[model samples]
Target chain A: MLLKVKNLNAGYGFLNVLWDVSLNIGKGEFVALIGPNGAGKSTVMKSISGLLPPKSGTITFDGQVINNQDCAVNCRSGLSYISEELNLFTGMTILENLEMGAQMLEDKNKARENLDFVFELFPRLEERISQYAGTLSGGERKMLAIARGLMSNPTMVLVDEPSLGLAPQVTDEVFNALRLLNRQGLTILLVEQNVTKTLKFSSRAYILEKGKVVLEGPSSELITNDHVRKIYLGT
Target chain B: MNNSRSIKAVEWLKSSGGITVTCTILVALAVSIHKGPYVLVNTLVTGGMWALMAIGVSLLFGVMNISNFAHGEYFMIGSLTAYYIMHPLKEYLLETPNSFLAFITPVLGIAGATLAGVIAGILTDKLIFAQLRKRNREGWLLNCFLITIGLSIILINLHMLIFGNTFKGVVNYWDVPSLALGDVYVSVDRVVVFFIAMLAILFFWYLMMYTTLGKKIRAVAQDENGARMVGIPVNRVYSTTFALACGFAALAGGSLLFMFPSYPTVGIAPLYNSWFIIILVGFGNVAGAVPGGFMIALFQVVTRTYMGEGWENVIPMFLISAILIFKPYGIFETKVRSVWEQ
Candidate 1:
């Protein structure tokens, strides 16, 4: 297993969000956690990424117990988490923003290589390299955020709500990019609301409701499960 | 491509870089023509010192969101540090003007002053600001202001108790003759101070522009949580930033020691002047503070020289108030982020 969460319970101040949420992701697997609004999906991602401290239980990544490690440390250790809001530095140029993502690396040549790879993955970013990030369109901004995550060259990527507030076509573009990355042997844990599309792309799926994992199985089996179809799939 | 290309020119003009250059050149021209070559040179020297202090003030304010009311106290501490350092070396420096000791003594004094300021700054962050931040309660903005104001009071009284209420000076240059450039009588020591200030400013500029630390500082300033998410140590950055800002303040204090009186309340004037420069440059823009300092210093020099000595203090206040009323976004067009959501 590349990442494991056992009996995890976490939340914000005075409001518990995740409860006994045990999950696992194998190396190079694309796993999706799908749920409705306020179902505590984001809280799970936050807890795993060390953005929020888990109330109890352990988050093990690459055989190391990393329950309360700082978010930056988690990032440096090759567990990249992309928040839903896509927090790119608006005042900086695209190149500068990418450089910030590659900031932890000691080798300048490696940083340059990462930069070239990001540019290759997202050519639009290269075209607008000199332009300030604030001016980029929604699709481009999302792409830049994902591209920045790749600059760190993580072992696994945890993305929260990649399709939120985007047009359908832009949504497809983002997922396709993630799918492409997963195919290239990067492990991914995705928390998303778009169930049908996510299930189609993911190798496995977990259905979260009210902070608990109600169902978990292969995407092919979950797609046919009656409870998933009735509640999440809106069949 | 064409649209982005066109917008790039507009962005450049609208950016802080455009205003800084334009303001500097325009002020240089006006001072030279109206105040003559001598006054222009004098203004540049003094303005350079004020600019250094303002850069520190604005950097802290921009990054940490603290007005740092004790900034003046840091300046006071800096000047006093230099005074005490020079006190023991005064007799030696006076007798050995052309000797290596003479040259090294002032350098030693400057370094001592800077180190003192940096220590004070680090302690302030660790003892006060860091505590406030750790508590992480609501209304931190107001809390920072009130705490810094209180710290300023404590520092002022502490300095009085330790150093007493006497004005001190480096006695080596008390009777030394000044070099003359036409009608302007430029003090040799002040000239050395000016060159050192310029070099310090350039060094700061380079650090912010091309360094990884600078990038981290900018990241933390833009978004603390985001920076942490990306693995930058936000707390350490805050402490370093405070130290750097106060270190620059000390540099200004050290440079101005040869020309200005060193007293317990000596920092008040520079502090007030830095506030004016920061405001005129606009908040949240560190680079703009440099040219902004130059603008205010020129105003003071010209007003005091041409109008009257009384007008020196009064003019800056009036000018800053008018600018605030009319163009509160500042001369560089920095956005007022608090007024409306983006």
Candidate 2:
């Protein structure tokens, strides 16, 4: 297994958001967690990314318990998290944003190689590398955020709401990029609102309602699963 | 053809930073032709030292969101530290004066002053600011200013009690020979002070631009939570930035002792001067503060030379009001942001 979470209970301040949530991802698998707005999907991603402390649970990655580790340390340990905020340093240029991801690396050559790899993945980013990130289109910003994550050369990536507030055409580009990365053997745990599109790309899917996992199965089965159909696909 | 050319010139002047630079150059040229090159050098040296203090203000406000109103007191303390150190050293050197010992005494005294400033900064952070940091209240900048205003008062009085009400003579540090060049004669001490200020400013610029620590400071300044997410210890950066600001202020104070007298309220005039510089350059714009300081210094020196010595006190206030009324972000607003945008 690349990543595992057991009975995760987490929240902000006194408000508990996640309860008894268990999930696991095998190496190189693409998994999706789908739900409506305010379904605690983002919170689960936050907890796994170590941005939020779990009230009760164990988050193990690569056989080490990484519950409540610092976000950067977790990132350095190969768990790249791209938050819903698309948290690129907006004031910085695109190249600087990518360089910041690999800032902790000692070998400049390694960082340069990673930068080249990211540029290969998102050539649009390379084309406009000198422009400030704030000026990028919504789709390009998402691509840049994912490319920044790749700069760290993470083993697994947890992405939240990649398609939020994007045009249908642009959303396809972002997801297609993720699919390409996944096919190259990077494990992915994605939290998204577009259940049908996410299911099409994911190997396995978990349907979350409110704070609980209502259903879980392979994506092929979940697409036809009656509960997922009624609650999500609107069929 | 001339009308179109003049319109283009007007457009260029109306653009960001163009008017400010043009105005500064005009003033500098007017001063040079009127007051001679010696006074120009003198004004630059004075401005350089003031710029160092302004840079401290900019850094503290930029990274920590705290405007260190008691910054001048740190400078005053540095001067006082130098005064206390030099008094004993002067007396000992007078008895069996060695040229090397005489040279080393002021150097050591300045070091002591810098150390004292850093220590005071650490204490201020641990005792007063750190508690407020934990509370993390809104209007914390206002809270910091209020507390620092009170701190400024307490520090002024404490200095009076400790060092006495009388102005302590700072003769040993600055009593160096003057160098004559053509019609202009410049003091070696002023030249040394200017070089030191430039070096210090360059060091800070290098630190913020190239180093990991500089990146961390900028990250914290941009977004504290974001910095923390990147594994930077935000609180530690805050404390270090504060200390560095204080150290810069102390260094300025130590350098000023060579030219000025040290008193309990010695920092009062410079405090107000720093406020003007902060306003002139905009708070948190460290790169602009140096040029802002020189502009103000030139304005003061020129006005004092032609108009009267009294205009030195009145001109900065007038300029501040004019700037606030028109360009409230200061002349170097765009430039400051661009310098760190990498």
Candidate 3:
């Protein structure tokens, strides 16, 4: 497996959000973690990405146990995380933002190749290279955020809700891009609220509630689960 | 980043800042034209340092949310550094006014002062603020305010104990004569200081706009999580931000060493003046501080000319009070949305 988590318990301050949540994903696989609001889905992503230290449990990535390592170290180790905040330098231009994403590259020359790849993924970024990130439309901002994550050229990308506040068409564009990326042999761990769409793209899915994982299986099987369709799917 | 569109607040410049600016310019022009160019030149000279100090304050409040009560201490450190360097060699520098040695001496002192400020900043941030950051910083704003106040007091007392409150400053780093503008003449030092401030602001702007380091700083300022997500070290950026702000303050102090002498209590006024600019420009409006500094300078110069010496301070206070009563947000208002956004 490219990534594995066992008995993960984490949260902010006294309120422990994730409780014994465990999941795993092999290389080149697309996996989804879907749950209701405050289901600790994002919390699990944060622990794995090293933004939040797990209260207890081990997060093994690429055969290495990265428990106390920070986000910067994880990023350098080829683990890219696109947070819900997007964190685009609002005062900076798109090009400058891209350069920041590629700042960890040991060789400056490779940054150009990464830039080309991200620009190809989101061409509107090229057209508006000089414009400030603050002015980008919502859909374009999501694309830029994802594109920025890709600029790191990570072994695995943990994306938290790329579709949030985005239209259906833009969400499809982002999902299709992720599917294409998974096919190209990059591991993806996505935390999204949209269940049906997530199950459609990802090979496997995990259902989380409150602070624990309730169900975990292949997306093909989970999509047909009665419990999922009744509550999450609102059918 | 949620882009929920809301009604933009009425900018102070379109109204109050506009009035203050237009009135200051009109009054300054008429007064200076009638009384000679002394007022205009003095405004320019004094305005330069004020602008630099204000920019530092703006960066602190906007980027780091550090209400630095000891900002002036950094300036004092710079001035002290410059005084130490220039005082002993004052004679040699005055003798060879245009020599390379003369030029480099002041530059070296200013550079040293900036280094001193950075060192002091690291001590305060890494040793103190970083620890506070590690804990529950829910009341961080109030905590930082008190901590900086305590820092200001400690530094002041420490300087008094060591340096004995004696005013120490150089006559001049160079022997260049004053420049005549119409009926009045202004010293070469003021012009140099003004240009230095402009250049520093320009350099800072370029660094922030183009460099990856700049992006990291801005990213940390906007959102720590965002910066972390992108692999930018947030804690390191915090320390760097504090250091940069202190360095800027120290540079201002060093450059204006001829005017502001080294004293234990020297930083207090500059700190207040910096806050004045921050208030006039809206707290954290980095770009607005430039003009706001000059506006404050003009008010001071004009008030001192017409009213007297101490009343210059009173005018700004009264004006700020009046402005606040009407447009409390200042010129370019920025609402604090999150812990990082402050």
Q: For model 1, state the Cα shift of residue A14 in Å.
A: 2.2
What would the TM-scores of all predictions be? 0.91, 0.87, 0.92
- Return the DockQ of model 1: 0.61
Which 10-residue span in candidate 3 chain B carries the lowest summed lDDT? Answer: B1-10
Question: Number of the top candidate by TM-score?
Answer: 3
List pairs with backbone clashes in candidate 1: A72-B231
Clashes of each: 1, 0, 0
Residue-level lDDT tens digits of model 3 in B1-342: 233322222343356666667787898899887767788877887787888888887787777787878899988888888788777666665565657777677778888888988888778889999999888668888888998999889888988998788999887766668887654677888888888888888888887766777778877776666677777878888888888888888888898888888899889888989998888778777778888888889899988888999898899999888777876778655454435443
Evaluated on chain B only, candidate 1 has a TM-score of 0.89
lDDT of 2 at A106: 73
Q: Between candidates 1 and 2, which one is better according to TM-score? A: 1
Please write out the lDDT profile of model 2 over residues B40-143, one tens digit for every residue. Answer: 88688889878888988888877777777898998898888878888788888889888888888878777888888888888888788889976735677689
Clashes of 2: 0
RMSD of each: 3.3, 4.3, 4.1
Each model's DockQ score:
0.61, 0.36, 0.58
